[model samples]
Target: MENKKEKKQSKGRRKIEINKISKKSSLNVTFSKRRQGLFNKAGEFCVLSGAEMAIITISPGGKTFTFGHPSADAILNRHLTGNSTSGESSTNLVKGFWWDEQSIESLDLEELNQYVESMEVLRKLVALKVDEMEKGSDQSPSDFLAMDSNSLLDAFASSEAENIE
Candidate 1:
């Protein structure tokens, strides 16, 4: 009798479509890995050039992460002060900035915007659940609960905002 062993074939890397990933679990996994890779590259660049670097990423799951070589705050502050040059002194232009003025890159502002969007989605879901409870919706509680966060959000995004409010 002869014994034969077959080797498992592995598919090498291939190009992927750049469209939005629809699967929630897969999307989250890909987002996290890519974000980590980006941060790692930035760190490498900083180490090689002795340059300051910062990266901020917002995930679809409402997670916020930051990477900095030196520190993210120091890099951001230098940029804001218009003194990114190696030998220049930075003036405090932010001192006189008004509250109404906006800096989208501000982590607080970015985080706040993300929080608001998440809350809006939650509110819509709650309103829908209440309405369905009263009307005896075709969708069962189990079915609704089984949906991933992204699916739940997508379903209610087009709902009547006034009614929900």
Candidate 2:
């Protein structure tokens, strides 16, 4: 019985005739089962390989089934709009900018944009740290001088003079 069904399915797929719909009684069921199998295979690949995939299928009657990577449209929109998050920073960005600033190799514009944004964030953090150090000296000169008296005192004094002026 199973072999007979398989044979019929093979025949139907090969002939692909508009006139011969695979006995409406079983055709819908077969289509549904096959579609599920395809979806399951896609899910397995995504889980094992960490791949982002989007699948869109249209049934013979024109119904559509779409699946993939958290949300297919969201990923596609991000790629098109050039939005970069710090958490999901692209590897290319890190390699291109920080690894070798002199390299002539071209990077994707979106990835380069992300790199520039990250660099700006780092620059802001460093500036903040410098400001905090200056404020620490202002808050406690003796404490600031404990580490290196002469140099700290000189810097603190200069910093204070600059503030006053």
Candidate 3:
């Protein structure tokens, strides 16, 4: 009697070259897999750090893919308006400006106009604050530091009232 042993096939991960994949089908498959992995990592980060995140990706075929802790549109609007629903610090607010210039260029004319208007309003508010400082207002830097959004708005409103009076 002859004994024959069957060898099992190993199904383990293999290292692949970092070069661009030439085959369309292979490239599509890789993109699909890697995109899911990237989204998963974003979700894990949100869960672990109690932070909110939104990801937007365009596939090679021009299809849009998005993942957000809340919703993509909501997260985007909040970032654009510089409103912090999560009480994040100013550093995180700066980080929200991570959108590429190409994305901004792709916005429609109406949206672009709105962005410009919002920036103008912000600029005017900053100028008002600077004027107040130059006029030697009683409100100190520490007072501004302790002010929340509503209080800051109130401060501005009171300043406007004083100017009117």
Best by lDDT: 3
Instruction: Show pairs that collide, candidate 2.
Output: none
Ranking 1 against 3 by TM-score, winner? 1
Better of 1 and 2 by lDDT: 1
lDDT of 2 by residue, 1-165 (tens): 555544433334354435545677577667667777987998899789877667776766566666666445555656678875423434433555445764435878877765665556546554755787777644232222223336644755565466458
Model 1, 101-120: lDDT tens per residue?
65556659657776566567
> What stretches of model 2 exceed 4 Å from their correct place?
1-21, 78-165
Candidate 1 segments whose C-alpha is farther than 4 A from its true place: 1-14, 86-165
Instruction: Compute the lDDT for candidate 2.
Output: 0.59
What lDDT does each candidate get?
Answer: 0.68, 0.59, 0.70
TM-score against truth, every candidate? 0.43, 0.35, 0.41
Q: Model 2 TM-score? A: 0.35
Q: What is candidate 2's CA lDDT for residue 62?
A: 62
Residue-level lDDT of model 3, residues 1-79, one tens digit each, is 6597778989789997689888988987787789889989998998898777788777676666777765465678789
Query: Sorted by TM-score, highest first, which candidate order results?
Result: 1, 3, 2
Q: Ten-residue segment with the worst summed lDDT in candidate 1?
A: 87-96
Ranking by lDDT: 3, 1, 2
